[model samples]
Target: MNARLSGDEKRGGACGTDNAGLTTSTGPRPRRRPPVPEESHLLKNAAIALAAAGTLLLASCGSSTAPSGGGRSVVDAAPCARSTAPEAQGMPSTERIFGWIEDLVGIGYRRTGTLEGEKAAAYVKCQFESLGLQDVHYETAKSWNWSATRSRLKVNGEAVDSFPVAHTYVTLDQPSVFSTGPDGLTAEIVDVGAGVPLQSVQGKIVMFDLKFLMPPALLALQIEFLWDPGLTTLEPTLVIGNPFVTSYATAVERAMEGGAVGFIGVLSDYFDSNKYYNEFYRRTQVTIPGVWVTKKEGARIRQMMGGGNRSANLVMEGFRKEATGRAVVGFLPGKSKDTIMVQSHHDSVFYGAVEDGSGTAAVLAQAQYYASQPAESRQKTMMFATFDTHFSGYQVHREFVRKYVIDKETPYNIVANVTLEHIGKQGIKGADDQLEITDKPELRAIIENMGPTLKLGMINSVIRHDLRRTALISGHVLCPIGALPTDAGFICAAGVPTASLIAGPNYLYDAADTLDKVAKDDLVPVTKVFIDLIDAIDATPTALIGLPLKSPLYESGAQD
Candidate 1:
């Protein structure tokens, strides 16, 4: 899983470290660091440093009582403690919130619909209900369930060792065997390095070096490169620079269009490790049979193609039907009954202990904190949701929003939707060091005031989330939220306003994306930021236009 890149190879790059040690990839250079032990210590120290000011407040409040000699309790002289303010009392303690995250990671991965996933959902519901919020329940939806069984690659009909690329939509189907026909589609080997353009793919199985550098342009001739001609018929035909050049969907579309059946791609520097697997699993959709060969295999393929062979046979198999999963939901109605939605997905590809267990924990901790507060302290009703099937084309999210939040006759005035995902890992190399705020300026300012205590920086980048669906279909201000780039990209594509925040680095989709990756200290600040954001939103007097008005209490039970 480790690939060494020389200094020249790593120029203008970000360095990344993983369980496989360290490496570089395409895109941006990862911020490099020392060994894990040192890094962990530094993170722990950073947490301590951040909490130093807050700890002093607790120190000043502590006092000891003494007993009277006559068996009667006697009051001991002590400095007057700081008054417990409403904000302090309403917000859950940092330790309590982080403890919940720890508890969740212990539960392992909760893949949608499994006993674990359901159990995690139930835990979330109970936390919401315990907060004294009313009408908490679960919303079920039909969804497709998928999991990879096995993946392998072979060269010249011989098995070559390989690893499953993250987020790659894989098929259980037999591998497609493609070969150059006897008449031999021949051409000189052209290394159209990275960033291959479409026009250059005429009759060759375009071979590009997997180096981080962009490839040289192909020379035009009477060459027949391996390109699906059918793609040429489409408006804005598939461009070569798109990272999805190797996507199964693109491949199948081209194949059916009677384009070049022989397709090959050099694994990008991004594939130096498996850390992106989870994100990949969540985003990739497979439509064709494909395999990811090693660098060596790619080089060999280039050699054979250079000798002028154009035909290849490919075999593919493995198909399954779609099914259903559930998104557990519960509500705590506030005095006003206008809503504030809090959400997290309960599913994971592997034991997504940190990918989202940390997120789920944050929501639950917030729920518990909100529940402990007096009834009147909360201005808006809070909806606690654990979405299922987020990875399966967002089916559950689409259906749930349409049925509950969007199409209702008496629409709830929702101020915001706060979603938490992948908040456990430390910062990754080349990752943005800010919480992407997708709200209007007024709301963004309110959030900014609460940022420092949580160690959160700000990124005003336009991104998407599941909330986008609610906003688009219902015109609600849905704030799509999370901590990683790929997930943020996914959310942005869905068109929801996104707030991206990361507690850790790029352990994203790898096997290293485990409980160990989560930093206990990061949870406290994240929880604090979320709680404050909710309060700030609730404090707004004017509701967004087009929401339903409140009905009289006496008419509460009347059916519409």
Candidate 2:
């Protein structure tokens, strides 16, 4: 995640910086004010603002509308093939994309290692089967199931607000709980900074008050934007992690290393409104027993620190045994062994309509499109792979690579990999996790009022590095390959050129990422572009798709 794009700041979004949910790598990355980094405390638009160097390439504006920055037209410089924009052509019905999204959402959430995950897998299998594709089947993998069946909390014999974190356990079955009462956990409560120092919280029940504060640079940039809306004076910088992928588990891990007995992270004002009931990191394991509390509850706990009756209790049970994960694979044969793999993660924290439902739909939609094409239309093999355990760290992707791409000496001949991620929205998240949709020029609101955080991030990330390009015009094809840890990360690590198509949604990793969060109409262009991506790569000679191995991050050996 420390990789730099030429002269830009180090953006982990393209690399495997976790929080890989979408707003898409660990979980989807959240959106910020603009180009200003998330730590800048400025605003959401600032993160995307950095791309404003007047060379902004917008997908919604189409090629007809040439985006002008610095009084210049960039339509001619776009990477898309002007002769034939196959990926941008043949738009699909919004209803079809919406229907797939709704069906996946209808099955509740698609969290990995859960029944919901399997259901989603089955549905994807059915979709591939209905398309009349060849050799469609389920690919099984394995991962630990860190389920939170029961978590009870109390303060001085009085029940209080609390919920168990994903892997807040000591052992798989005998994980410890947090309780403070006459007979429960009666340690001295220590109120400290975000991640309490080792000396400050050693041997105590550390309480970390969380604050979604932006960095100083972002804060200053945001103030500047308030004074100017059109904002042509400053260059657009790269947006930091939309929400800056803060991990409670990582914070708790630090606390544990500091000698703390128990840990509790209090949600800030941001979560109180935008994501009050978020269950983060359910797909990943935790090293310590932990839970989250509201800001109000945190204050109360802090106030009771010195009180004689101050105490609490946490009882968490129901740690399930290891589980079997599944991945759905479908292939449309071509004349040769050269394979172009297109994938998306089916597992999500919530319904994840935009976070990944849109991605899955894009894959299916592309399948439908290619299926309609003549058999000889494709010269290389096209694969639609929807994976699970993405929440647990892209295990399905790794397994697929090992079996299909690297099993034999000659390999499966996978030349290019495309990952379909969060798409079709109209907003980016700002300070306090606020959704700002009405302000920016890059944010294309496909479904009316909602924002397209994921799409917006993608536009800025892949194109911002191109110093010569300015606007995203018609036939402006971008090389999707990068150093980011995307769904195609495993394949890319194996030296196969990869491109990840995703956007940031404000509530990507939480339950709030529901059906309404997705802009149905936006799906048309996102899917169309995806089609063109497949067509573009397939039509190009394998040697031309640029695969940059600039950093060790390109080495794909880890699970995600």
Candidate 3:
């Protein structure tokens, strides 16, 4: 018998009055020393002294609240306190897992379909196998084919070094030259504020300061927010400097279709020579001739553009092709033979230590830990999958879900489909809206209990990610969209009930997303949360009563 929750059934009180699970702490927990007024005054004096010593600071220091009778400062009081089981230990260790991630980053950029990418896949496969996972395999999918040869910029015949942003278009032999129009192609420099508005950018290279100087998160968020709305109306033929926009593909397509001659993206000031060189050589192509200018060079160009240096030369060279990528798959069978799927993508844009490497590691570790459990402890069959081509059309995911998941004729019902994306960062920001489906109260209870253990918040409303697709198809409750820096939130669009864990190291896509960004302390807790969630789901009785068996005639046909 096939058992599933109807759309209406799934829309009930999944987020009921589980106030017992909620904490009412209004401030941060106190674990250390009480506040000292005298010390605060001394610190203020010290700050003034330091400033007099020719140092400038931008500190947001504040006065501390008086201590309570218990000798704990108001600022140091615990906001939320809950009882823990005596035998229950904290979540799994993220440090050990990050060590493995560091080793993977050491392998360099795992561009889709490359030898390095495949080798990385193999290493991941081995890791899963070592964890005792069964039927481990790789699935190939298509990826964009493009590579960069060389990029350079020149002003007044002076050569400048440049970096190539990923997915930016490059021209092979044609170098684009810019000139101010009317007589010599001259236009007044205009600060279009945020570059989202391109109404007045016609016939001139629109310049903006969207390049993030410190943390790339600011830029990533700006780009993600702007690209979806700005791309359609902004019609600048040429754009200069990284405006913190989406994929270079979008910019290139816009510029090309808009009749823009060329683009000059400014590299972030945080670019490391070694890292940039490593990542630059690892560039993949999309559609246009775009190049990255160094911070210094970009500054010079900005000055020249400001000073009416209308005649500037830019050139980019590259080509695109249709390439193939792969997704890895493995399975662990259970008593009922029904499948409960767990998935994370293996491919990445850069080193991707946090974007998804952390998620991948978590899934692999959970599979290992669960497989190590005694056979009697197992309940439903577990499907472990690492999808590919997530960055492109989400081809592999769509194919897999359509074929092996939804199309299966057996009584192999999908109890839960958990998809992990980016989960190695701190601070969870859920989607703008809550899912309309009703959640299984039992599942919500487990999640609530696990939240404190994992240092996570059980948010009712959040954005959709990879698992959203499955939710749409299966209509399962408890759908979660993992927190990350990117738009990997479309998973819930498919209607799969999902829940995501947030533990990312930093904003994704930028060079700052190295293995070092992942917090060692956060890993294990996130892992434990996933493991606990799986256990809870597996323990839930399937809504159905009978299990389907394969027939001898079907077996014979399969053999033939």
Candidate 4:
């Protein structure tokens, strides 16, 4: 979920320079790193570093031991009312929240650094202004803008449906993995299956299988940790789509090192469709040119390959340049200086009705609710934000963390964060091997890094709202990233207690994530739960809110 690339040199170039230069009725704004050879190498280094650090931290830590960056202990801080359930008096209605989703999805594919992305940011800013929120502005960061204008794969001069792999650096102006002009790359095709072939494939096109870790297989390994609140049948409903999980990136690296001119991926576990828009590339300087094909199409291509010697033409044309990444921000003043930030990203690969359209709606709902109340009613100020660059990279996220939370650049102090994402239906690979989306709400988690009191409050809120199939999962439990896996994961690691509600569905990154994908029925309930959570946090003292260093789920050192 994190964008690994750093733009230290190119950052702040367009921090306040909006392409449209349209000022809000109110007004203005504000604003990385090493060069890695390949994305695979970069990811390997990151994984090793994170894993080693986690092991070391877990080895010396106990279950009750809090991390170094945490606030005062429960013994020293004032306690909050834990037995009572929060009221949803001012929460937005389901129609109001879902309407935001419809409006966002209407502005097709808001990929970061594009005109559509800017439009999305503008829309969020307008929402904040409509609520009369103060200091509505755009916080910008640099992004490596890449968009595929056209991509094609032809076998024996016949066209085969294909989509360019997200963020693969393919251009004619630079020294990328496969640099071709309008003629494109014409070469012999070789099938490498799931393994990285050792045979010389110099100047040839490599075709390899890309596997996704099925939810069923993942549940078989970690079923004990999975908690369902008696919502529905607990079946495998999501797939681990990270290419790194299945070593697809490694295969691409090996192919590149083996002198392959280009590559084609057979989506072995995809839902019999090819319009896959995976953003796991993390904006690394990857130069490989690749496209994804469906399982059925892959089978046909394999059959064609068996006939005789054949050549294929791979054409992928896209623009890669420096672009601005924005984060729309505003604040609601309260009696206290402590701030509880409500956040979600506005950028998406496709329609993203659930990937984050639902999340943006959640943020809007919270903002609308809070702003409607008098300032004296709120104990802590609320910061409402919808970030960009989620799909491109996390540069904007990092920038916000640096300038706002870590640096305390603003007058308000951010004591906690609540992030919402992917409120959608449960999806699974059906009996016929097709993607089946169910009507029930997705089994989700409120990944939290809070103390005992706050944790109990979250559990109570979930139950009170009848948010079935949802659990209060510890943020530190078996997560590859040190904190929660949601957008608030980074902030949680920064030691501000965070509760991020999220779910993983099969169509999260695909064009199939339409308006119908959002769990419209649960919109009001989900918003109410967060409303209860924020009220609980505001009531509790900051000192007792966080648990910086908690033990992993297993003593064996795999963190959640």
Candidate 5:
């Protein structure tokens, strides 16, 4: 039966792509290009270009090989040996995708707009160059950044381990063992559990178990579910109420408003939520020296100063500055002036092996697949981009539109968009890293370690980027209409056609999103469907590629 979708479904759930052509072992053999004067010129220019980009290359040719992710060159790049001659039927390879994973996540945590982020972008550029893509270059823009240099906490004259919350602002010097810097004052600890009182914690360090409030619409949905007990299916939305994703900044603001010297975040899920988790956000003016601790740590501090006046020291030195971030883009000319733009953000919060490294690897796989195919197979020009500033406000995507799409800066009319994110790792829904056992014996027997299923969005783009072709094709296979606007909203808002495939994993913004969290063998199914979608987009006519744009809810000319 075809999946019947309503407007209520939001983000993720299990679905099927088990159809003909989704997994065909054989495909049409591509035609090769005859060597000619133009081909000779192109080959010569490509060699010259690769020679010039040696300084920007990932590493030297003679670099020693190391184990996967252990800091050795995985493979020598074929930058100067791209042939226009057609290869066999090309598709994304899972093994090579994992190699790309080891390549990026092996580097380290790559927060947006940082030096590490720039280095990651450079690697992406090199990968594109190795794939024989032309016009591979870095598109850079200056953006604000945030970092936590040091944070210390002491209880009852004893030092305790602590970490600063990401994206929160702080500048407190260690004045004394019991008192913080110029901003903090001597006072007893306040155990304000998830509730903030503006006047109660004055001159005190307010440590609360960070509270998570679901966005209003999702809240109502859950209430309705309880009201109607027989309602079997859930709305396909990302509705988990986690404070790290939805509450960290708001709680900090409330604490600062209450005139607290420093703020402490007691992790809501001490068993699961790692204390090293970062609250990734844009730079905001209303920031306070904020640190997070486990629930056990909170309990220890509460016991230390029971019903008596005692002071504890808190120091936070956060790094904030404007830095240049780089985005890599490469072009493969096709049969038409129209374009298909495919992208994924490479910047990560921690090791980011999964939150985005998986997505980045998927993009690399797609690039390699496309490069291996004959250029004549493409009906539209293809632009592959690895973006930065994902943990930020997606400023890079916004800027790319303003300068190139809306500015009429380029000749290619980008008719479609294909975006990929977080397609690795089946979620183990318990604290001890165990699979959630169901009450029904039958269900448990058949369950396996499967990565979180992909959520394919079947929406027309509202803005500058067009990703509709890939999405429309997926609709015929497994695309559903309930995908939330986590990433595509920016492009869709611009009236572009877009297709997005993502796995809304719980550890998306946490340090626990390490390489190990990524699924080793689950990428094949997702890639198989992805290749089919690309073919569909290439064959579909432009007139039917996207839905007619719906009228805006409010006029842009009107002020708020």
Candidate 6:
């Protein structure tokens, strides 16, 4: 679904593809490049260009000698050769990394606790084992499975299309089901534009618009002042402009407190579509029943209730049962007990090709690369984990943290974490001001909470690989405590220094997130960035990973 800009001045031009196949503005010109077959990875010729310089060992290289741990050897030949940069070597190809994404996309609808979600977990496990990763197994966590069998909404005797807002429950007698009863619910409709300062909603169904906050380019300029990767050329649109909602969960709570029997949310900012999976899975409690409708449907309902008190009948039938969310875990133990975790989530509400299939593929690529190396060469043990339960409220993530990071009896000591998520194309304004996916890679950010040593590694890697429009922003700057932007956020909060690569494409939760949405061009480049980051963390003393008071890359007067 496309996004409609709200109350913000539009900059840049309508999105169009230039002769080079890169994103070009129809109104104003910037630059363009050739298509993939004609063009190559940005770093493709680094080895050739730097032939005069000494070659470095590429982690993706194959070794006949198996790893020290009870691990098998990876048989596939390496796709990339040695690089000029020492820590950044042996890059994986877009085909190799994206192949893993294609495998996950083939298993459709990987929502948490569903059969397809389990299939995705199985696939990740198989990939781990096939990549010669050790201790490849499933770690289970308590979770719930929910599905809406039937949902219907009628306003003033006219039936309107609707879908049950994800994770919302009804006052059912049985513990396993959430339904509006056999007769359904009928009540007067109350319009609360944005659900603030709730009034006159008691005993009625509250209808409100769900507002999303789009990060404007000006905000990106401010973030750059705090910390920029020193990019010679920057695309402000690609500077992490993902839209987010700060109040949908709070609005539900307010409506329930105001005695609203049920609620209806209008996806006002989203493109004309009701199949949105937004606000589907957060850790908040949702006792009051709610549903979502597109903006077009919402306008009609509002018009019907404009003058007199109109009635609405809502019916939603579904079952919420006990289920288990599992995380696929594999290991490569080094000489020391200190561990570095490479992770991403496996479950998603839709096809999730970019929402997480891309991240999961990165985990597999890193695991394959590291597994190909000898265990003796590793400075710290590596744990490759693709977590489940991201949609079911991150149960598996919290469980992993509790067991490994917090629990005293746990075997491994995780010192640092490298997480990958959402490597995809940027969204731009098109005809009719609708949001459209462009050929350019989505704005990417490395939300990191680390010391100068490792942070410098992050900057150098991003710049070295030419990962354009990327920032090394601090995690706390984006989200406060308990709300970091990445799944591995808990690790950072737990004092384990982390670098999480994430982008917020507007269609992240929509059905449009298909295989094509995956940022194919940046696949290898992203992996190379994290590989270099891990190596930098490994070289740093564990105590110094998160010890710096100020960023070395920060200019004295950079901030205004």
lDDT of 2 by residue, 1-560 (tens): 23333211111101111110121111222332111113324332443343332123322221112233434232221222111212212344676566667656644456776655665676566556555567777787776455666666666666767766555654533334323333444455666756545575666677786554332123232121121233422442223333324545456766777777776778653344323333334333455566777666776776675576656666555554466778888888887778888788777766677667878878877876776677798989888889887766455666777787667444358877777777644344455545554222223211100013323433443333221111221111112233243465566555666655444444566555666667655566566655655676677777665442322333443333
List, residue by residue over 309-416, the lDDT tens digit for candidate 1.
533333332333354566666666677867776777766654455566667766766775676667687777877777767555555765665465445534555445
Residue-level lDDT tens digits of model 4 in 105-155: 655567886655765776676556655578877788887567777778899
Q: Top model by lDDT, which number?
A: 4
Q: What are the lDDT scores of the predictions, listed in order? A: 0.40, 0.53, 0.42, 0.67, 0.52, 0.66
Using TM-score as the measure, what is the rank order of every candidate, best first? 6, 4, 5, 2, 3, 1
Candidate 1: lDDT over CA atoms? 0.40
lDDT of 4: 0.67
Off by over 4 Å in 2: 1-91, 156-158, 170-186, 200-202, 210-244, 247-250, 273-285, 304-310, 408-411, 424-485, 548-560
Residue 397 of model 1, lDDT score = 67
Q: Report the error of model 2 at residue 558, Å.
A: 5.2
**Candidate 6 regions off by >4 Å?**
1-91, 170-175, 214-244, 279-283, 307-309, 432-435, 476-480, 548-560
TM-score, every prediction: 0.54, 0.67, 0.56, 0.77, 0.68, 0.77
- Alpha-carbon deviation at 439 in model 6, angstroms: 1.3
lDDT of each residue in 195-236, candidate 3, tens digit only: 332453444443333343223222232221111122321322
Find the number of clashing residue pairs for candidate 2.
86
Q: Compared with the true structure, what per-residue lDDT tens digits does model 6 show for residues 47-129? A: 23332121122122221111212342212222222222222223456765776666566555677766567657766765666
Model 3 segments more than 4 A misplaced = 1-96, 170-193, 196-254, 266-286, 293-299, 409-413, 421-491, 502-507, 541-560
The root-mean-square deviation over C-alpha atoms between each candidate and the true structure, in angstroms, is 17.8, 16.7, 19.4, 15.7, 14.8, 14.0
Whole-model alpha-carbon lDDT for candidate 2: 0.53
lDDT of 5 by residue, 71-165 (tens): 43322222322322222125544555665665566444566655456556656765676566788776776655676556777766777667877
Q: In what order do the candidates fall by lDDT, top score first?
A: 4, 6, 2, 5, 3, 1
In angstroms, give how far residue 249 of model 1 lies from its true place. Answer: 6.7
